[model samples]
Target chain A: MGLKEYAGKQIEIDDDGFVVNVSDWNEEIAKAIAAENSLTNLNAQHWQVINFMRKKFTEDGDTPSVRALGKLSGVSIKELYELFPKGPAKLAAKIAGVPKPRGCI
Target chain B: MSKEAIERVSIIISKGSLEGVYPGLIMANGARMEGIEANLFFTFFGMDAINKSHYENIKVAAVGNPGLHIPTLLGCIPGMSALITSQMNKTMAKLDIPPIPEFLEMIADSGAGIYACQATVEMFKLKKENFISQLSGIITVGEFYQMAAGGQIVFT
Candidate 1:
């Protein structure tokens, strides 16, 4: 794990740039990461998707795919891209402070 | 930037068998998950994966498949393919892997490009309407090569 400083706090990240410790997460970190990804604002929809992914990761030990996120998060994949740009699943997971999703992330 | 980032991934699915098709599907999904653009081009019998009526029917091939390590005679036994397919589906479901249609929906929803080979489509007497709506287009080999130029290409 690599230590990165953001918002005056240290966070652990994997070689792949995914967060290694979820407990080190906070709103500030999320916002910072999102901004780094070119998402300027975190809206209700983005929050919904983020919270949903965090919850799923906590329960399932794996993140849902974009399809599942679409069906369950009430956010379409196209909209996810609009929100997270190139890799919505990975970028969203990163902002949500979770490990990158395997298949659909 | 060394290789900077992979901008796109082009997957060529050349077989209709589940084992062949799933690899491409899985990889494309993985690529999109990583924030890279993924394009899947189905060629030859691989066209079955995009055929709306037939996509869901793709079955695991247990016969003469060295990957399975089953004895040749055992694989030749009747009902082996069906049994293998059933078992594979069960395992996939246990892992929460989506079915064919759902996988397609996910890939497309992830903004990956899904294309079919024009030569294969014509050879199989298939039309644009015969494929699922997720298909971006029926492209010629020239077009596919053009699409794969300078990007990663996977032949599955």
Candidate 2:
């Protein structure tokens, strides 16, 4: 389930396709994962959401919910789907190198 | 990616207050977050949650709500409900919880099935136009119960 090829760079990922090591993630890895999910051309809006989630995960030890993302990420819920599609919290958290959000489902 | 362990969850939204509406929304979105399919059944006063016009303005049900920890007598005081709602909203903002409408939009976009109860719509004379666009459509109890078969069911 690894999409490790980022311009020939390799990194291990979990079975759910989330990067296993947070530190292994960088701009290239994030871009690769985003494109793999059919979200190409990571824009300022994309990076803003990703960076905010990463920062939140670092401080709170958990990723915020879709509700939280919609509120604090400077992106509306409708726009989030336009950017990440289906599940923005899950997709963005995976790209941002965070665990699946706790108690979500 | 390996398959997620849980597949489907059906949640019932039965209360109209802000507090009640959100738990269902949060849980439904949570299920989608985990790659689990989700269905929401809006019934009784809960139908207010799906009303395009009313849902946006839902407020905390402060009076007679034990969760608010306001004594019944104090809760009757003037402006108490609004004050409590204002405080709750501030804390929710700090926690980054979206308002009811945004949460509903997130839920729908996550592929969660939103079903309004058949009986309630008829009882309230609610037309299809009264509902938000995301509803899978109004459904009978028999249909919803069948859809909920073999899946976890939550009542809110």
Candidate 3:
């Protein structure tokens, strides 16, 4: 509910495909992510990634597990992390352009 | 320059280094920023940047670069490419600039004209899917020249 609690929540997915809760989400962050990834369609996969990313960020105050994500997405771990500099939660949430998770900024 | 203009700037991109790649990317991106109609025709080694498989895996060769004197033995090591590329990419990232694929995607999404040379496409046996999905189409040199005739041109 508050910024501290929000930051502590899981906002993104780890490299291992585990849920990472995010405490907050915002608009500028969303647009920046969307623009960075050039995501054309915010389909189910996008949501899955975005939601997980936010959760991961909230829970850890860091981006999801990059190496683990590569194993999960089938994209080279190197390539996957490179695609999202700010990590999945921020990028996915940005692309979805949704409100930050329940309690995030 | 408009489609109807006769005098245009033209640029030919033929290198594939991180530095080499910059000429084409910077020129094209800069051209679009200036409201000039720019056409990027990727051929030979330059095609690596747009080739779907190599887009994200692009690397800079240290040997024979005329800039770096890295030993050939060291140059051949695994992970070296990733190390060099990550550094280049990270610098670009810090500047808030997107990678080549992302930049191309944004430009293509914005309606700028992009073409993979037919000769090169055939040389590499590249298909439409080999390049990013946003390309308008593969075109011949004749067609590329037609567009090049009226715009500013630079060769990287």
Candidate 4:
């Protein structure tokens, strides 16, 4: 893990670039991370997924899997891919300031 | 670990039994979850995985499967395969693993390519309609190799 500046704050990040502390997350930091990952826009739909991920992580202590995200996040699996591109669950979890989800599906 | 990361994977499923098929499906799905490109090639009896009639009813081979720990002689009894298959299905469900058809759908929606072998389709008198809609196409070994280019090839 290492510290990197986002939204003018030095936040710890993991090797894969996920935020190390969930508490350090803010809208500005999320936007900065999203911009760095080539997601220039965090529209309402994008916020829907990001907020859902953060809520789940806060309540359940882990991010949801892709299948769970598709079924429960009010975002279809195909659209989640559209929003996050390569890996929906992992990317969304990263942007939401959560650890990478565990599980295959 | 190698300095180079795996960017893509081609998994070949050549068996029809439940145990034989899930490994390939799980691996391909796992690859997609990791942001790696994935493709599944179903050949020979593995076609049952994509076959419209058989994909949902795949059985566990009770006979000659030492993992089951049952006497081989008893495996020949009627209903043995069905009994074991139902038990395994319940276990998988408890683990939140979807059924075969649903799993295939999830993999496809994740943008992994799913295909059936051309030679196997011909030998089995199968057509496009025989496969699940998630199938990318009926492709030959050569075409599969093209999809597998620049990636790891796994057989399960």
Considering just the first chain, candidate 1 attains a TM-score of: 0.91
**What clash pairs does model 4 have?**
none
Question: How do the residues B34-145 of candidate 3 rate in per-residue lDDT, one tens digit apiece?
Answer: 3355677777888887888887776777566546567777767888767877887887776556677777764453335677889988988889988888777788989887
| Candidate 1 residue-wise lDDT, A9-92, digit = tens | 988889977778888898899888888777889999899889999988888888777767877888887788777766777788
* Candidate 3 stretches greater than 4 Å from native: A1-105, B1-8
The TM-score each candidate achieves on chain A is 0.91, 0.87, 0.39, 0.97
Model 3 residue A80 CA deviation (Å) reads: 28
B46 in model 1: Cα distance from truth in Å?
0.5
- Model 2, range B1-156, lDDT digits (tens) per residue? 996477789999999888888888888887777667799999998889889989877778768899877788998888877788778878886776767776777788777889999999999999999999988989999999899998989999
After TM-score superposition, what is the CA distance of residue B130 in candidate 3 from its true location, in Å? 1.5
Q: Of the pair 1 and 4, which is ahead by DockQ?
A: 4
Candidate 1: residue A30 Cα off by (Å): 1.4
The DockQ score of candidate 1 comes to 0.61
Error of 4 at B85 (Å): 1.6
Candidate 2 chain A has its poorest 10 consecutive residues by lDDT at A96-105
